[model samples]
Structure formats: C-alpha cells, structure tokens
Target: MNGTNKGGAAPGRGGGLASPRFAAVMASQALSLLGMEILQFVLPLHLLNLTGSGALYGGVIAAGFVPYTLLAPIGGVIADRTRKRGVMIAVDAVLAIAMAAYLFAAGTSAVIAATVAVLMLAFAAQALYQPCVQSAIPHLVESHEVERAVALVNQVGMLTGIGGPVAGGIAFGFLGLAPIVFISAACFAASALVVAALVHVPYEPPARTAGAVATARADLKEALAFLRSRPLMWRTIMAATLVNLFGSSFFNVCSPYIVTETLGLPNQLMGVLQGALAVGGLAGGAIVAAVPGTLGIRRVPALLLGVVAGIAAIACVLMVPLPALGTYTALVILYLPTMAVCMCMSIVATSYLQVESPGTLVGKVMALAIMLANCVTPAGQLAYGVALDIVPAWAIALVAASVTAAVAWWLARAER
Candidate 1:
C-alpha cells in the first residue's frame, strides 16, 4: 500500500491496518460481486418460471439499470456531501434487508416487487458507494500503487464473476432461489462489517460551502460544467457510452437466449461461458499489473487493438458453423479474451479519470459518466430486443461488434 501520489509528493504513508483494510475491502467487494452474480442467475430463472416470457426476463435485468440512470446524480451528490463510510455501511444494510425481503417472498409477483425494490435501493447505494470507493483509494495507499489497487479491484470483480454464477447454478439446482438470496444478503452484511472495521480512511471535513438544497443544485451544475470544459473527459464518456450501448446491451439482452435457444446449450454450459469471461478478465488484470507504467498513457493503443481483435474473435464465432457444444466452447474462448481486453481498457480509462481529475469534483464527474453510460445500456438492450425479431442473432451481433470496434477505434484516435 506504500505508493506515490498524483501530485508527486511522497507523503508519509501510514502503515497501521493498511493490509487489513485492503483485505477487508477486497473481501467485501468479492462477496458483493458473488451475491450480484447469484442474483443475476436466479432472477432470470425466476422471471422465466413466473412469466414464461423472454421479455419479462429482459425487463428484470433492465429494471436494475433504471436507478443507475435516474438516481445516480443524487447518489453522487450525497456521497460528496456525506461520510463515505457511513453511506457505504448504510447502503449495505439496506441491500441486505432488501435481499432478505426477496428471500421471504417466493412467487413471481413477490419476486418482481422485491427485485424492483432491491434494485432501486441498491442502485442508489451503488451510485454513492462506487464514487466513494474510487475517491477513497488515494487516501488509503501511496499514489504509485493506485494502478495495482485498481487492478485488484477489477480482479475482485472478476473473481466474483467467475465464481458467483457457477455457485448460483449449483445452488439453484439443489437449494433453489432462497439460497441465492441468502448468499447475496450475506455478502452485503459482510461488506457492511468490513466498512465498519476500516480505520485508516483520511477524513475530509464536511463541505460547509453549500446548504442541502442549493448546494445540491450547484454541485450538479458545477460538475456538469467541469465535464464540459474537459474535451478528453467528454470523449472518454462518449466512447464508454457507445460501447455499452451496442456491445454491452447486445450481450446482456441476447446472450442468455442465444445460449438457451439458439446455441441449444444447457444452463451449466452458460455458467461456463460466464466463468470464462471472468477468467479472461483476471488475465487482463494480470497483464495490466505486470506492465509497469501508466496504463492510461502506455497501453491505450495496445488496449484498443486488443478490443478490436477481441471483437473480431467474437464476430468470428458467428461465422463458424458449429454444433451446440462447439459453439458454446467457441463462445467461452472468444468471451474470455474479449471481456479481458475490454475490461482492461475500461480499468485503465477509469483509473485515469480518477487519478487525473480534481479530487473534490471526482464524485460528480464519475456520477455523470456512469449515468450517461448506463442510460444507453437499456436503450441498447431495447434496440437489440426489437432487432432480434427481424434480424438474425448473428447479424445483430455482427452489427454490434462492428459498431463497437469502429467506436473504439475512433475513441483511441480521439483520445490520442
């Protein structure tokens, strides 16, 4: 955790509990990710069983993003204004309670209601928590370690991505949805505990500049104005937004059905696909870590190249005529490298933003970026959902891949 600062000032890095704090944060994040993955698996299965409609399954996933779009700004403001640890702890508690509610209620209507409620609350928490965590990293470690810290964060996410679904699938087969809920609840609760245990967070005095009502509006305005002034930030946001809109949307909306229907793959095979993506993500993180430099500066072109190459690999899967097993295996292979490269680039971009931006305004800028990027995800999902009716799945995927590649290329050039 002993590292450098963005300012190039080698401040006396505190040692007490830094290791423990890092461990606590990683464990909590891993648990939270596991919980989310379990829910991702179970929620769809629940929706499918309850409504027997693919659209409903899509809707369930879409519902989670709603708050990311609507409440993210508010969440950002609150995180900036409030104590991050307290906010994080409170949100974790709320999420735990929400999951508990879902566990108690078993039917479709109840599940939907619970899902909506949890998502609304969880989204609000995430909006606040994410910025807080991002902002807090600098406070916890030396500046030089920021990249590693960011990579570790991505790694934790990947670990959850790899493990959560597989465990959820197993749990689903034997113990059912309740187990998933219980696991999610446990993760949140554990995260809350970890937050409570954190002792080294450098305290920033409360912002005394603005009142609650006026301050919020001004903060939002200032944040937006700040972003407008930075062309690079705007371009980065645009690139991320477009990628999410096309690539992320298509994958989320189409992948499950593609596996279950088009590819005729079993649920277990789908789990493997998910796991493979995580594995790719882990590998990407390792690559990022091993390379010693500002990934934001050093690897931009290479990252974009990987993205283009990975997208082509994925697109190639569509052209290959293979049986279900072969297709699933091909997808797993394609998925790992694609996701790894994509995530590495994303991590670099995010770390760059966090490190380079003014600390005071970091929450607002990130919130806006998240809001804009997330807003497009649902639109992408909706567009693909409609397109699937008329267009072949492979055709839709090809378009998405092509669009994403072109956008990524444009972004790379624009960023440079």
Candidate 2:
C-alpha cells in the first residue's frame, strides 16, 4: 500500500516533525481539534443551563459517543481504502458547514434538538476522522519515531484543549454561544484548507474482488483473525476498557455536576478545571514524546494504580471541610496529575498497538482495539450520570477508585 513520498521521505522510514507533510497534518489537526474541543466544553454548559438535569446532560454527552463507538470500524475501512488527506479535508469542511448552519438555528425552538444533532454529527465525524490520522502516523514517521509522532498527535489536541474550554467558557460567559460557534466554524474551515493544500499521505489503491460491503466484512475479519492470535493485545484492550469505564467516564460525567451543583462553583471555574484536564494530557504527551521508551507497557499497571490513588484522593478532598474555592483548588491540583497519569497510560497502550500491528492491518486493528476500549465509555457515562443523582460525590469517587484498582490488578496479573 506504500507509495513514493512527496515533500518527505518514504513511509515508516523517514520524516520526523521536520517533514513538511507531517507538520501540515499536525497543523490541520490542531485547528480542527481546537474547534471541536471548544464546542465540547461549551455544549454541556448550554445543555445544563437549558435542562438543569445531570441525567439529561450526561445522556447528551453519552449520545455523542454512541455513534463514535459504532462508526469507528467503518472509519477504519475508509482509512485503509481511501486517501487520508482527502478524508481529513472533507470531514473538517463538513463540520464547518454544520456549525455555521447551527449558528442561525440557535434562536429557534429546535435549539436543544439541533444542539444534540450537531454534537452527534461532530462525534460521528470524529470517529471517522481519527482512524485516518492515527493510521497515517506510522506512514509519516520512521519506525523508531512512531511513539514521538503519536505523542505529538496527542499533544496537539491536548494543547488546544487547554485553551479551548477556557476560551469557550469566557466567550460563552460574555458573548454567548454565537461567537464561539463562529470561531469553531472558522477553525474547521481553516483546518480543511491546511489539509487540502499541505498534508501529503502516500496512497495505493486497495485490491477488491467483492462488493464494498463484502470487502469491508472481509477486511474486518482479517483484522479480527490477527487480533485473535495476539492474546496480549486482547488483554491490553480489556485493561484499557476497564480504565475508560471507571476512570475517564467518572470524571467526564461527574466533574460538571460536582463543580457546578455540589460545590456551587461558577461556570468560569468549570472551564478552568476542564482546561486543567487538558493540561494534564499535554504534559503526559510531552513526557512520552521526550522519553518514549521510559514508560513501557510494563509500567501501565503502575500508571493505572496511580489513577486509582488520584480518584481516592478526590474522595478525601470531598470529605474535607473546605471553602468552595479551596475545594476547587484541591480538585485542580489533584486532577491535573491524575489526568497526566491517565494520559500516559493511554499513550503507552496506543503506542504498543501501533508498534505491534503491521502497516496494512494497522487501521482495522487500531479501530477494533479502540472500539472495544471505547465501547464501554458511553455506558459508564450513563451509569455515572444516574449515579450522581443519588450518590454522594465522595462515595462515587471511592467506588470508582475501587473498580479501577481491580482493573489495575488484572492488568498487572496479565503483564506478569
């Protein structure tokens, strides 16, 4: 499937960040992710204001992930078959148009429905878009630089994420949703241009003997057969799935509720915490990029244990008698490091998968692995959403920590 490289060296043998094509892809992703992250932060706040129901807020968030989970495998097929640059350019353009259309419809009675619909579309696009990007990484960089490239990719999103929520919150606070939507649309539009003009992905036509549907099925079966032979990959996927369920989903659902409702913090502070989450990810990606081999798959269990400790600490913080600002401060301090650990674990798992899979199978294999790991996230979101209504934040934290601890245990046993 490899083609002669343009504006860079051949696939998997040359080009680090110095390559023009690699830099262009990074730039495009940065803009696209900035837009997406801004909306990601803004939408929940909008829904929370409109409904004031944790269950509804959580449901809307989970609804977005539903399509993401379902469409990921299809995305893998598209990525493996088509030109990645075209896919990136097209998806960003579509997202820009969707946001622009939604801007005008914001004043209508259909605002809530429109919001959910637009968000789901965005999430769906992300499911289709990301596999192309992830699969392309190995093709763009030398084999040894794959981890750094992956870290760089993760960092771009995390970097934008750090500013997106804070900027979105401030914009929403003062200018309302229209301006944020406009900015997001502009960012996506810019991303499309960047990818179309500069990003270069080596491509070769995939051979097909059957119809499209049959081909897709066969491709998926090939991927599954490959995975079935790799028990370590399955174990890794299982451990990652548990972490996503208990660790990430808990914060995703509980953070807004705890910050806004339980702690009575302002909307702006919520934005800060969200940005802090990104900061953690940014830091984690930096660590991996700087020292790619320092933390290997063997260390993942310890990282998961670190996440357990972080969640348990959150429970203790909630139990403490502190002022609202103090509690918020404690959370930011605690969450930043904890999220960094989670990010490291995620990068390690992804880097391992990328290294293990062959280039031809990378897209489908990554998609399947990611789908299995991510499939539980929506369920966890919904479960925690409902749990927040009846359970204390402290108790929920403790339970989440306990569940994640079990996952860590399983991971350690498997690794041993």
Candidate 3:
C-alpha cells in the first residue's frame, strides 16, 4: 500500500490506526528483547565464574560486535534484496538452535566455542533485523506517527530491560546457566512464531542482475558517500561512539563488581541496579513519546548530547561519600533520573535518524554507526580493566565521568 491516504493519515491494510500485523511484529520484538536482556546478565556472569579474568570477559563481549563491523553492510544488502520476514525467521531459528546446542554442552570447551558461534550469528541477525523493522514502520504507519511508533518500540525494550536481568539472575541462582540458555532459546523461537503468525510484509524483488558484483560495490560506495556529505551525521556518530565508550564500559564489569565489592550487596542487588537503569530508560521513552510534533528534528541530537553531559556531571556527584543510608538513597535516586534523561535523549536521536534518512541507505548508515560505536567499546573495557588494577574504583568512575562530559560537549557544538 502507499504510505498515506487522502486525509494524510497513515494507510493500513484495513481502516485502523495501526495495522494488526505491525503490532504483532512489535510484540515479537519485545519478547525477543526480554530474552536478550536475560542473556546479557547470564553470559558475562558465567564467563567470570569460569575464567575470573576481566580481560577475557571483555574480549567475549567484544567478539559479538566484531562481526557487526565486518558483516553489517552485507546484512543490509541481504535485507533489502531478500524477503525481510523470511530472513528474520531464518535468523531467529538459527540462533535458537545454536543456543540450545550451547545449553546442552554447558561448561565444556565446546560450550564456549558454541556460545561464541551463537552470539556471532545472533549479532548478524540483529544487524539485519533492525533495519527491516525500522523500514517496515513507515510502510505500516503514517509519517506523523513514526515518532510515536519508535517511542513505543523503545518503551517495550526498556520495560524488558527492567525485567530481563532480574529474571536472569533468579534463574541463574536457582536453575543454573543451562536453564537460562534454554529459556533464551525458547524465547527466540516464540518470537519467530509470533512474526510468522502476524506479519505479512511484502517480499522484495530480486536484483535484475543476479550476480552483479559491480552494482554491490556501487551500493556500498553510495551509502558511504551519503554519510560523508552530512556533517551532522558524522558528529552524531562520534558523539554516540564516545558516549558508549565511557558509559557502557563500566556496564560490562563495574555493576557486578560494585555489588560484590563496594557496597557488599548480593547478586540480587546487582540485578536490581541493572533493572533500575532500565526503569529510568522507560521514563525517558515516555518523555520522548510526549514531545510535540512541531519541533525540528535537529533539536533531538543536540538535546541528547546535553543530557549526556548532565549524566556525566551527576555521576561525578554520586561518586562522593555519604554519611547516612538516607543520604546515599537520595543520591542514588537523583543519579537514576539523570541516567534516564540521557537514555531518553539518545532514543530520540535514534528515532530521528531512522525517519530522516533514506530507506535504501538507512541500513548501511545505521550499521556503520553502530559498528563504530561498538568497535571502541572493547578498548573502553580494556581501559577499565587496567585502571581497576591500579586506580581505585571511585577514581576510575570519576575519570570516566570527566571524559564523557568533555566528549558530550564537544559533540554538542561540533556540527553547529
């Protein structure tokens, strides 16, 4: 169907606000995210239990992103040229099988090998599936509704983020890692089934010249050239890269360490902290959903950078000592909201990019941007690992906060 009707509302298969098929797709994605959140905690914890090496744990996380750098462009091409729904289903099935294999072989050398393989496949699937999902939204909804649609998706993800870790930790504590992996596999299978039942996305036509190598090269070049032409795109990408480097670096190791080391909190408390951040993210998503339609898209990127700056500054303050339980609780409360604001801004920027960019080029641009952001994460984790050896945890946190604030401001002003 054409994207719009004479009334300027988004046209769906039937006369409705949103296509049922599209809603089903969203539901599947939400479930998939929930499962992913569980695995996010379980995987690293398992690695630490097995090896106890910070560097090795960091490497395992880095390996997943490495394929995105190498294969995302290709994945984008496949998404555009093939049937997107089928591609998603195939990818999901493969991931589920791989995860199941890992579960069956838990704790062996084979388990690690299989786990890495499954993660790589999952990463590739994620790269392809994201663009397909984003591209599908415009087709299913009105242009004016794009922002709301994106916000809803982000909200679902955030909600899952809040629950996934808590559930994962419980499962790990009670059922062990094998059960966690099996459950994750089941979630992926469920997601695939939901997609199959609900979505009827149209199949893309095949390329006219089936084996046209030169045409593929041209597509890659054009996507890169388009990115280079937009200064704001480059600056936004740089901003996101730096933010991920400083902010998420600690996420890979610090939260677990903090719970176990500093506060002498239990694993359950660690789960709560991780889940609380997601609650903050959900609040941010709500704020984005509430924004008026008249504002310029350019404001999104700038506001997001500002929020990042605020987060860094607030983090610095939270690092200070408190004499009482009540004071520390107040500080934690304040820090959570700051994190939410930063996450909300970032989500808005992501939505703006998805809507503003051309459909054919969107996949490549997103892939490249994510790859750049993720590539540096390993380095950040490595830095944190080394710093933890010499510098105190609070000092490392302060340094990270300082660097993030500086980078955020630089990014805010860079394009303007």
Candidate 4:
C-alpha cells in the first residue's frame, strides 16, 4: 500500500516533492494546465474580437466568478466529506466534457451568452477542484515539504503558462479554435485519469451525533471560527481580495483592449504578453522552492506595495503611443515583476495556510477564506467594466493601484 509502489508518495521526513504520488499529480496537472491556459487566452480574445466592446469583455469575465464564489464553501465541504481523489477526478472529467462548449462558441450566434456559459462551467469545476488539490498537498508530503510542494505545483502551472499561451496564440491563429478545444478536452480527460490512479489521502468525516444539516452547519462554523482566531487569515484574505479587485482589469480588459484594440495588434501577439507573466511565475516558483521562508508572512504587505507600484507603471505605459510590437514588449516587461512578486506571495501564503490548519478542516477553511475574499471581486470586476466605458484604461489601472496600496497598508496595520 506504499505510495511508491502504487504511485503514492512516502510520508514523514523522507517525503518531499520527489515522491511518486506528487510526481504523478504534477504530471497530470501539467496536462490539464496546458489545455486550460490555451482556452483562457482564447476565450477572452474570442469575446473581445467578437464584440469589440471592452465593457462587454469585462462583464463576461465578471459573470463567470459568481458561480465559483458561491460554490466554494459547498465544494470545500464536499472535498472534506468525500474522498479527495473522487472529487478531483469527477470535476476534471466534468470539465473535460464542458470543453465542448467552446466548439459551439466558434460560430457567431449568441457569442456573449456562449462565452459566459463556458466561463461559468469552467469556473464551477475549478471551484470544486481547487480546494481538493490544495487540501491534498498536506497529505502528499511530509510536514516540512509543504512549501516546496506548493511551489512545485505552482511551478507546474507556470510551466504550462509559459508554453500554453504562446502555443494557444499560434494554435488559435493558424489552426483556429476547433483543434484547441479538442486538445483542452483531451488534457482534462488525461488529468482525471491521472488523479484516478493516485493513492487515496486519509480523510474521515468528523464524528457528530447531530443530524446531517446540523453536522454541516457545525463543520462550517468551526472553519469560520478558526478563521476568526487567526489575524493572518483575515489579512491574507483582504490582501488577496484587493489584488483581485484592482488587478482583474489588467487581464480581463486592459491587456486585451490595449493590445488588440488600442495598439491595433494581432491577436497572436497576446501570447507574448501573457507568456511574460508565466515566465515570472516560473522564476518565482524556483526561488520560493529554494528559499521558502525568505519572505515572512508579516511582510506580505510590502510585497503588495511592489505589486501596486508595478500596476501604476503599467498604467503609465498603457497610455504611451508606441508601435504594436513595442507596446506588447513594454507591457510584458512591466508584468514580469508584478507576476513574480504575486507568485511568490501566493506560495508563501499557501504554505502558511498549510502549516496552520489541521488536515481535517483545511479544505473548508481555505475554501471559506477564498469564498469570502471573492465576494468583492465580482463587484470590482463589474465596476471595472463600467469604468472601462467611462474612463481611459490608464486612469482605471492607476486608481485601482492606489486604492490597492492603501488597502494593503491597512491590512498590515490591522494585523500589527
């Protein structure tokens, strides 16, 4: 029953990122991520070109978040109550089936509706799937390898990000959307199969003498109570929410709008710009893996400050009238530090979460934190949509950055 023989990982001090189970998970993750990154790039670009409206683009992106946010707590409970592998396997399989929506999106009829539906479907699966994966981290390795495991998983994502966007752009441009959609489906199916083969992590429903509803309520209440006791939890959640609030526009509307509409660049050029963010992620993951605790949890505010400054700089360049390729290169350059810091901060926080929570409640706790934080995101994204119509993208980015800096400072002070 050892993880090594069954593609499971070893436990205790010997366990690290090198374990077979983690290795298998990473391989499966890579396959799904490759397809996902492609669709992520394609979906927005398809919407932008189809509608030619920045507001509509942002609105579509914003709509997809509602379901994911709503499903987070429910998903977390499901992850805790059921076998983690089953939750992951089922969700990935469902997502694979959902990828078919893209083929329908190729045609022009009801493109906005189709876009929103597909986005919702993908997010819904992610809402259920993400916590299971995060929760699985502790079970996969020894206590010590938590940070390294998080970084390695993140590194897998960035690896795909590096290739997925570029491949997506080229694939979408030359081959169009059909083949890309099929590839995405196959990748998700592969991910499900890989997870299906993973050794089961230990999980048992908490003993409760009460009824099912009472048990669910008590379980949720405990996760909330635990969250309330930890100042770091709230601080981290606020900081992340602020990032999503102020930063969503950069990807949701600003980058695409500036690259395709403002700068008059080809859709394929977006690959180069997005690939820059992934490049930063790749580097960040390496550093985080090597020196996991280099940046303390308390200093996350300082990191957030750097992100705000980066966004401000990005806003400035967005207004400059540069040639298409030059502009793409400039945005890519600006995004590097921002993405790098964000990726590192993400690793640090995720590690902190793992260290602090017990395996029994980690899934629910993390999911609730994420869910609460995301509540504000839809509003921010939607407001950004309205702002896109009223103001230049520069002003929106600049203002969002400033507000984010203020929020980050507040979190630091509050935590102190």
Best by TM-score: 2
lDDT tens readout by residue for model 3, 225-332: 876797776677777788678867765565565454455545565676777778887887788778734334455445554555544554554466754343335435
Candidate 2, residues 77-101, lDDT tens digits: the string is 9999999988898999999999999
lDDT score for residue 245 of model 3? 82
Q: Per-residue CA lDDT of candidate 4, range 1-416, in tens? A: 00121112235723567888778778877877776777667887877887777788778777888898999988888777778788878877877887876576568787667778888888777788778877777777876677788899999999899888888887888887788788888889988888888645666565679876777788889888987897777678877887777775556557777777777787778777778889988888898888866776777888888888888898888778877677678888888888888888888877777667766787888789779878778778778776776788789888878987897789778877
Each candidate's TM vs. the true structure? 0.90, 0.96, 0.86, 0.92
Q: How accurate is candidate 1 locally (lDDT)?
A: 0.71
Candidate 1 C-alpha lDDT tens digits along 339-387: 8887788777777766666667667667877897788676676667666
Ranking by lDDT: 2, 4, 1, 3
Candidate with better lDDT, 1 vs 4: 4
- What is the Å distance of residue 108 in model 2 from its true position? 3.0
- Relative to the true structure, how large is the alpha-carbon lDDT of every model? 0.71, 0.86, 0.66, 0.78
Q: Candidate 4: where is the Cα deviation over 4 Å?
A: 1-14, 208-212
- Ranking of candidates on TM-score, top first: 2, 4, 1, 3
Estimate candidate 1's RMSD in Å: 3.0
Residue-level error in angstroms, candidate 1, position 94: 1.0
Q: Candidate 3: TM-score?
A: 0.86
